[model samples]
Target: MQQIDAKQAMAFVRQRRDTTDPTYLFSDLDRERRQQAFIASVSHQLKDAGTFTDIGKMQGVLDAVSKNIVVDSDLNLIQLAQQATSLTGGNISFSTLPITGFGTSPDGASINTVDVKQVQATVKELLTPVPLAPVPTTTAIPTAATTSPAAPASEAAPASGAAAPAPATPSAPASNVYADSTGALQGGAIACVK
Candidate 1:
């Protein structure tokens, strides 16, 4: 596991390029742009590559290399290349060098195996995918965003527009509860006298 900074990795890439090719001229400005482009491209490539790893049990190993892809199996490398093609407009191929090695079990135990050519061929087979053009789709369309309403416009006060309000009608006063000089209630429903 290694964290490679953009500048350091670009310098390494520049060193690896063939200096003898005069046609491959790159200035300092170009180098900077290339570095930024490469970082962006690889970031996009990894994002696409994440989808492939979600479908398998080897996700732990995939996660380890998800952010930093330096060593990976042939199958993973092919998947990464395919993802790169889908995410970035670049064709990529996968291949492994010829080397003899012991096989390992899923639990990381070494197993006895002696076929180097088969491994190399398998790696070569992983590189056969061609670049794929991104299909036009609406899956990533953003949700409907609501904007804030504008403030109300200022208005001049109206002149001579107010009308006089109608006078409220007086409610009929309730009948007087007090009795007359005789000291008896006038209504028969209530028996109290004033």
Candidate 2:
């Protein structure tokens, strides 16, 4: 639940650029160009960012740059944001929703696109927990207990020639864990023309 301001994020992007183009202000880049450049730049930086979350830093990079930041969560987002900022030091987890497609705009601005329907489905799948293989455990098997006969007619077994049914054993429930398709935090290469 951490975020970097657009200007600072862009600064990181600029530092990572390998362009041979003439030096120019970051502002000079078109919106689409800035986004493309940012993605290309940070794709590698993400890996080296290191772990900032407990258990693990779930790494996720945006496929496209955003001009605004929104605090949306299962809990009161504003309260969560305030609490997060108030902490002197806290863990950060990165998560990404990637593009499923890409195309150029009519204005010649390179654009990255996503399928909203597909994304909705993917989001559900990504959030849903999966069952981990059950760990095999062994326990003592039950032994039949001996009984003493008191010659009580009412307590004696029925003489209908029927046998008693054995008891049924219970099984343990399957263990479930969240899915981690991205594997580990690592730098990835992005191809682009300066």
Candidate 3:
């Protein structure tokens, strides 16, 4: 892979050429993947090249990007950068929302068709925090001297005839939305994109 400057990076991310090539970007989703790849590359490069540690390089990058990037009014760039310092290249991953199929719009423009319910479900799954596995507990066995006399099964049963509630089960892991899709992009390297 070749190193690219900001201008080349912008062009690479924005280009919509080569629709016929299976490996190249043609759809809006492909462009988004390219954009995500670019961001990952830049983030990795910034950390790899020690740009964050170098005030001059950091200022240069800020000066260049501040012109093109927008942020909330109260966002502190320094604080954000500080926070970002803890994020490694491995921390970044990107995936586009799943699309059903391609369709022609009323205006004859091509569009990706998506299932709204599936999208909602996928989003909900992505947002829901996974429950942590229960820590293994050790129950000490009582010695014969310490153990109480065994009670009859009927006596141990609740008077109301209700059974004890079962322990809650952990939710299954989220399904990978990108498993059958090509829109997944990972960080830590310069990903080839259209």
Candidate 4:
């Protein structure tokens, strides 16, 4: 139930070794990267005291995570490790936050500056669970507009010898998906994402 911070590690290193070398070792890493490292370290520690011998190790790390980790229950750990591995699309949480732009510091030590609030806000957005939108409900009512032509402008007079305007060919229905094998489908039809 104890929290470990980079500052604490730095302090310990400083105390034991009597030097500040630890702080300088990984200070170049940005906030997101550092946070990611922390999450990964913690996740590994939980699995086998700093080893990844579990089957869900990769999937666990790829899921979203927050700086604040809750450990009262193993499953209630999305804040520290997202568990919806099936939907993660093979993404990981330890990635670095995008940089606003590239520039040099006053002291000439190359640096990547990020807005503190913006970065945290973005991280929160990633951690929050999004409700799946309700699929639009529509009756599968059949209509003939696509099958039948416009009744040839009912009652309109035709010009002398002008070949009756060729009946317009029915256009292809929109297909959002394509299948390798066909099943009970006509040449053209509207397909949803499903």
lDDT of 1 by residue, 1-194 (tens): 35578687757556533478978744443444555566565655555666434545235545575456433233444444344334344432222344354467899975545477886576555433443444445656564542455344344333488764344554432232332334533322222111
Q: Which lDDT values do the candidates have, in the order given? A: 0.46, 0.42, 0.66, 0.45
Cα lDDT tens digits for candidate 4, 1-194: 55768788544333322245656434334443554555455554555532233435533543432223322223333322323232132333344555576569999966778888888787666545554444556677758854666545777556797766565454432222333324433322212222
Misplaced by over 4 Å in model 2 are 1-10, 13-18, 21-95, 98-101, 115-117, 131-194
For candidate 3, lDDT tens digit of each residue in 1-194? Answer: 68988698888998766756777648777788888888887788798888766767766876776576643344345654554555555766575789999899999998899999999888777655677667656688779954878567656655487885456677554322333224433221122333
Question: Against the hidden true structure, what lDDT does model 1 obtain?
Answer: 0.46
Which regions of candidate 4 deviate over 4 angstroms?
Answer: 1-70, 74-91, 97-114, 128-134, 142-194
Q: How high a TM-score does candidate 4 get?
A: 0.26
Q: What clash pairs does model 1 have? A: none
Model 2 score (lDDT):
0.42
Clash statistics: count for each candidate: 0, 1, 0, 0
lDDT of 4 at 74: 30
In model 2, what lDDT does residue 132 have? 49
* Cα-based TM-score, every candidate: 0.20, 0.28, 0.59, 0.26
Residue 20, model 1, lDDT = 83
Candidate 3: clashing pairs of residues: none
The list of candidate 1 runs beyond 4 A from truth reads 1-12, 15-29, 49-194
The TM-score ranking, best first, is: 3, 2, 4, 1
